[model samples]
Target: LGFALTCQYLAARCAFGYGTDLRAAVFRHIQTLSQTELDKLGSSTLINRITNDVTASQSGVNMFIRLASRAPFLVVGAIVMALLIDWQLSLIFLIIAPIVGFLLYFVMHRTIPMYGANQKRLDRIARRTGENLDGVRVIRAFARQKQEDERFAEDCAELERSMLAAGRISAVLNPLTFLILNLGIVAVLWFGGGHVDTGRLSQGDLTAFANYMTQILLAMVQLANLIQILTKAQASSLRIAEVLETKSSMQDGTETPDTASEEAICFEHVTFGYPGAGDPALEDISFTLQKGQTLGLIGGTGSGKSTLAALITRSYDPTEGNVRVFGKDVRSYKGTALHRCIGTVPQKAVLFTGTIAENLRWADEHADEQTIREALETAQAAEFVDAMQYGLETHLVQGGRNLSGGQKQRLTIARALAGKPAMLILDDSMSALDYATDAALRKALAERQGMTTVVISQRATSLMHADLILVLEDGRCVGQGTHSELLETCEVYREIYEASAK
Candidate 1:
């Protein structure tokens, strides 16, 4: 009944919504992670913490409650029974006590650290495996499957070696304990025989004395097992605590800014680095976009375009300087207020397995069907969606595999637009669309939307009509102005324009 009630409480408290909220908290904690910390281990190790480490901790807690609650009563009961039988024979148990205690102590001290190290290694293996799985299509296409297989095999082997070593060491503990215990029993027999021969101990007394010796050792063995379990649990608890206790470097500010501004977005002398990076990904960058203005950003890959977007979204904080939205530091307007105002379509369009309407609803769950359809129309996705058998209700496979690349991009755009955000960021979202489709989408946005927009693109055609164009080279802004001005004054912009034109 106690076990059932305990399970019921856990089940009720850890139901789907509760578990999801907890996992989200844990997930967010992992996101603002430092490269140094993540690099020190692997994804597999983190998974172990979320899975095996947690299990070990719960098992240890259960073991502790069971053994600690019962051991004292059993020990006291056995001691009293032994004294009633023959007090002298009970003295034989003292000879073997220290040996068992020392063995348990030895396992306790050494095994805890080993378990910790082993969990770390398991995380490494998980990280490697997760990376390979996510990139399996690329691996196969590039004929690198064999290489990945070798890498995965090596990780698996390392995990096996660590587990085997720990298991082998722990294996010796139980048997050695019993061996010393049986030796103590042998000594009792040898000593008890003399007592029996001298007529000092009765037959029932001798029989009961033997039973008492067995019970005491069994009780000690249980205690030893409990110690071993507790040690492992302690190690695991420390690891989980480390993650749960870590403060996100990008904590939201306590104060919120209610004052809106004409400047929709601003980056003021921003400098940022990944955790522990020697050089900043972005340095002393500054820019501003007025309400309803379209700002075009062009740069080479890794020139910090995505990092800029992440900073704008407040996914991370600048090491020095500030990113402001609505004329207030973004840190101040966090949680729902800031995010609801910005719509971002990442470089890769990710779609969950759901109906088209459901996916769009993520942008605004309260949005009606008319709002969903209008957003789709603005994205130039209404035509395709209407052609489908289920229209907005059509089920999508994982990652929107049922749709073509352009369709997925349009769907993502529609989803972003459904929120009717104050600011819109399209991070190379048009890459998968054809030139004609891209032009159509741009035209539709120009005619329909009044929000501030930032478009990151490699193609010159995508930004030819922007109010302002910022050209980046090697992480520095090389040119900033209208397209016509850039073409006339900026050599790099001219070169990029000519190359794309050709």
Candidate 2:
């Protein structure tokens, strides 16, 4: 009993320990994967790999630890005792063992590939479920809930079909074992009884032979359980290994930007597109901006304004040409160092589940409340934030679902402001605000004075005040000048200005 308890303790530790390590390994690999790699491996599939696949691997570890130290020992000991009783009867043990071994091998070999396909089907089901939950609002707004349900059901049915197919293959192992082992037992009895009558074997000896045969059967059963886990784990491990083996496309540079230049950003002949995307999102886009200069990007939808912003922040490398910062290539800065110098607010405002202070602190880990308050003021978010009873301590739900759109945008801007980044990119973030608030926010941002700023907006008023405005269309800059210069020289700018004037 004490020995059994010890085995259980070791098994638990081994399973949980290996599982914890595996989860960490997978997570770290995910962090190293490029944005393209991440898109290729969907969130649902990655989640499945880290959680369900790791858990399956844990089960394999548990079975190994529990049976490894005990089963072989018992089987060998039992067989040795049986041979002492009757060497002839022990030969029956050898003959049946090989047959059982062959069957177990066949089952394991056949089921491994099936298990791999099953895991992939599981990924599809998990992905569909995640999409359904995350996009529930959009689904309901479109009144496609029933269609989504059908889609989810289809993926789940596929998973179930794969599971059933693998289960059927696994099921054959036990029945085959029983049939062969039962035959071996009958042979042991037949021969042992004859020896007993011939006075070569005692009744006690014959009974011991039967017990040995039963012990061999039990060991084979345990081995079968272990093999089943191994086949499953083999599939999961291969999946995990695939992720680990994938090299990140974005390589980190060893050096920081040059120290002598105040010009914080420059893009030269930049053209870029997603892999397999037929057309370049931005083509031959060249621009330069110094410290304290505000460059406004004005373009219609699909005109590549946001894509240009992504390049400046080094979210991705330009397929052709250089994005430079401080007279050095943007690729020269390490990932964390590159982000440290840029504060960006996306079109959609995203906030985490935390108190207002905690969310702001993600920008500057040690920022004081005064810094936070100042940023909120600059964003024109302080009015509502201070009116709240908790103020900076106000709690937010996931995605800031508890806050209004304009409020979320303001908080997001404030969080970025608090970080005191060297450059700020507002990617159409002012769309949620009223004209009055938008003007106020822009004035406050301009008052910051020395920071380089790039504002991407469709609003003519937003770009009109910028020192330089670039009008984009069809992935190229058809116009690059001040708002007034563009209106005089560029027809596209004239149309946009005329439209917004009304």
Candidate 3:
């Protein structure tokens, strides 16, 4: 019993290690994937593959290690002993083995596909659950609780149906296996009893033969259970392999940007469309900004403002023409090299659970307290951070749920500023701030010398003072000039400004 316990412990430890290594490898690979690839494979599906699928495969490995050799060895050894005891009576072995093999094969063939479909249903349920959790506020704000609950219930119901369908097929294996073995045992009893009565077989040999038959039956049942586990593992491994084998669409570059260059950014006839999208998000866009210049991007919703910013960050390569930074093609800069030069505040303000100082340190791990405070001052976040009990040491919950919207936005901006990047892109990050705070942030940004800035905003007043303003409409560059120049030459700009004026 101690030996058995030791073997079980070793098997469990091996499986645990296997799962940890597999999850780590998958997570590392996911970091290499481009934004386009990530969008194509949704977060929920990837999460399911890395977690649930890995666990299933790990369980299979454990079971295989424990029973794979023992069950078959026992079955084969029992058959041989029965043959020696009475070769004629051992005919039952041949008939029963084939029938059991066929039954297992039939069940495996039917269940493998069902298991695959069941995993997909699981992905759907995961996706729904994630959507609900992430958008709980929106759901409640719109009074969509009932509708969302109903939708989630439908997903749960579908998953239940899928699991039940697979379970029903698998349930037949054990009972049918037992029935076949029981019938074979009855055959053995009848034939062995007749032989014993004629003195062809001893009563002792008949009893021993029956014992061997019982051993074979138990071994075969264990084998059947192993096959069920293997089938599920096979299905899950296929899913895991799909993720492992997927080559990232984006390749890393070796060279870094030249810091000495005067031109900060240039977009030359660049056009881009999302993967599997019907139309281009940006078309024939061309522009250039010199070092220290402030460029403003103004557009309505879906006008490709953020998409254009993504191009500068090399989040997705442009489909046509080139995007250059620091006098070289943006594609030539290595991933980390480019990221180091550009600090970006995305439309959504995301913060992890940590102290404010810890969050700011993400941009520059070696940044000192003075540097963090300076960034906060520039972002107009100093006032609030200083007022908090612990100041920069104040702890934020996941997504900064404890903070107001404007405060989160400011903190994100400060995190970006903490890096002292060569170029900064604020992608509508000021929407949460009041007008005075927005002006203060911009004024502070203006004080930073030789830092190229791109501000994407709907508020015309925000961009009116920028050195150059580009008006975008339906993915086209409709106007490019100073704010006053666009108001005169561009009807779209005039309409937008007039509306904002109201």
- The TM-score leader among the candidates is 3
Q: What is the lDDT of residue 93 in candidate 2?
A: 81
Q: Write one digit per residue (lDDT tens) for candidate 3, span 221-322.
A: 888898899899999988888888888787888999876689999999999999888889999999999999999999999999999999999999999999
Off by over 4 Å in 2: 258-260
Tens digit per residue, CA lDDT, model 2, 370-483: 899899999999999989999889999999999999999999999999998888999999898999999999999999968888998878988788888999998999999998
Candidate 1 segments exceeding 4 Å error: 1-45, 66-68, 224-232, 255-260
The residue pairs in collision within model 1 are 43-127, 44-123, 44-126, 44-127, 45-123
Ranking by lDDT: 3, 2, 1
Best by lDDT: 3
lDDT of each structure? Answer: 0.80, 0.88, 0.92
- Per-model TM-score, in order, reads 0.89, 0.95, 0.96
Give the Cα error of residue 345 in candidate 1, in Å: 1.2
